[model samples]
Target: MERKVLEVINLKKHYKGNKAVDGISFHLNAGEIVGLTGPNGAGKTTTIKCILGLLRKTKGRILVDGMDSTKQESKYKLAYIPETPDIYPMLTVWEHLKFIALAYYIDNWQEYGSEILKRFDLWDKKDSLGRDLSKGMRQKLSICCALLHKPDVFLVDEPLVGLDPKAIRELKDAFKALRAEGKSLLISTHMLDTAEGLCDRIVVLKKGTLIMEGTIEDLRHKVNAGEDTSLEDLFLEVTEDEKE
Candidate 1:
């Protein structure tokens, strides 16, 4: 059996009257990419943050490589690239990489970091301060930082947003390469078409609840959709209900 790199069991996060992430469960295997997708306010981000331990979950458990996600060892095995890149305005593009290296205790990261920068088309902007880079550039820099540590699992939110065509292509290739290296990725995205091609499987959320989870073919079967039905169409069909 394939090893599970990440697992969320009966996960939930609730505010005073809001069920941001109702009971949901999913697991990501090593060398796999699972897309977490749905319309706005669907709890996609909440689920990810819960796994990252950024926001406390009101119920349920999270595991990283079979260890409690709150453990230091588990944290070291994870990396996250949020939808909105939160880079230090005072740090240069290259400085950000250096900081990650220091935090992760990665030795000889210069060569690898240089190659990553080149791959993402950020080598030329290495000296540019984070505040000076555009949204796209900042996003690229955030990816580079996340990659430098070579974590076992990656949580990427809206990864394709703010990226140019070439950057988008490069990021897609990088995702494939990471999978090849036995890394697991949980990608939260609204870009259904992109997710269809890239993800090994998908987990759909609605009103903080998991509505669907399966391979494309499996999802098609669940909805009785024909072979050519796109993920977008399938999503609309499953989430057509007005009431939660």
Candidate 2:
């Protein structure tokens, strides 16, 4: 059997007196795409931070490819695209690509970089300084850097915010291509339509607690919703019940 690409057990993260993520757990197998979603302040980003080892977890464990994510502290095999593109003001777009490719030890970076830039419609701006690119273009550059490595897992946070319609279509296609290569994706986004269209499974949270998780059909049934229920409707139904 293919080993689980990622696993989380009783994951929790607390800040001061409040819990940002509370005892929520899930797993993603190779080729699976899971959408981690909820409203603002719902612990979606918090859980993502714990997985990336950016924020220390208060409790529980996360294993990537059966390796302890905390102890082993593996860096590669996972690629992350944050909500904001982290770019150096001085580096040209091509420079950024060279830096990321070197960090991942991928030779023939010129060849790989061109492919990504072309795919994201960013090739024309290859010589532009990072600070000079448009927001959408910058975001595409960030994605290009991550994909140059071809990591086993891709973790993205609200990736659709700055994308134009064409860019959005391109990104969705890229994710599909990666999944076809047996990669796993754990994406945290508030765009319900994209989540509904893209994810193989959906995991929802409210105030740090897991309120719903499963395939779309499974989640709909869990809430006794209609078979054709939309994710937006199901989310409202599930979250509304939590308030009562």
Q: Residues 1-244, candidate 2: write the lDDT tens digits.
A: 8679899899999989899998999999999899998889999998988988999999999988888887644557778988888988799989999998777678887997898888777889888999998767777788888888777898989988877898788778878877887989998988888999999999988899999899999988898989889999999998888789
lDDT of 1: 0.91
* C-alpha TM-scores of all predictions: 0.91, 0.92
After superposition of all CA atoms, the RMSD between model 2 and the true structure is 1.8
User: Cα lDDT for residue 176, model 2?
Assistant: 88
lDDT of 1 at 69: 91
lDDT of 1 by residue, 159-186 (tens): 8887788777877887898788798999
Q: Give candidate 2 regions above 4 Å deviation.
A: 71-73, 105-108
- The per-candidate count of clashes, in order, stands at 0, 0
| Model 2 TM-score, 2 decimals | 0.92
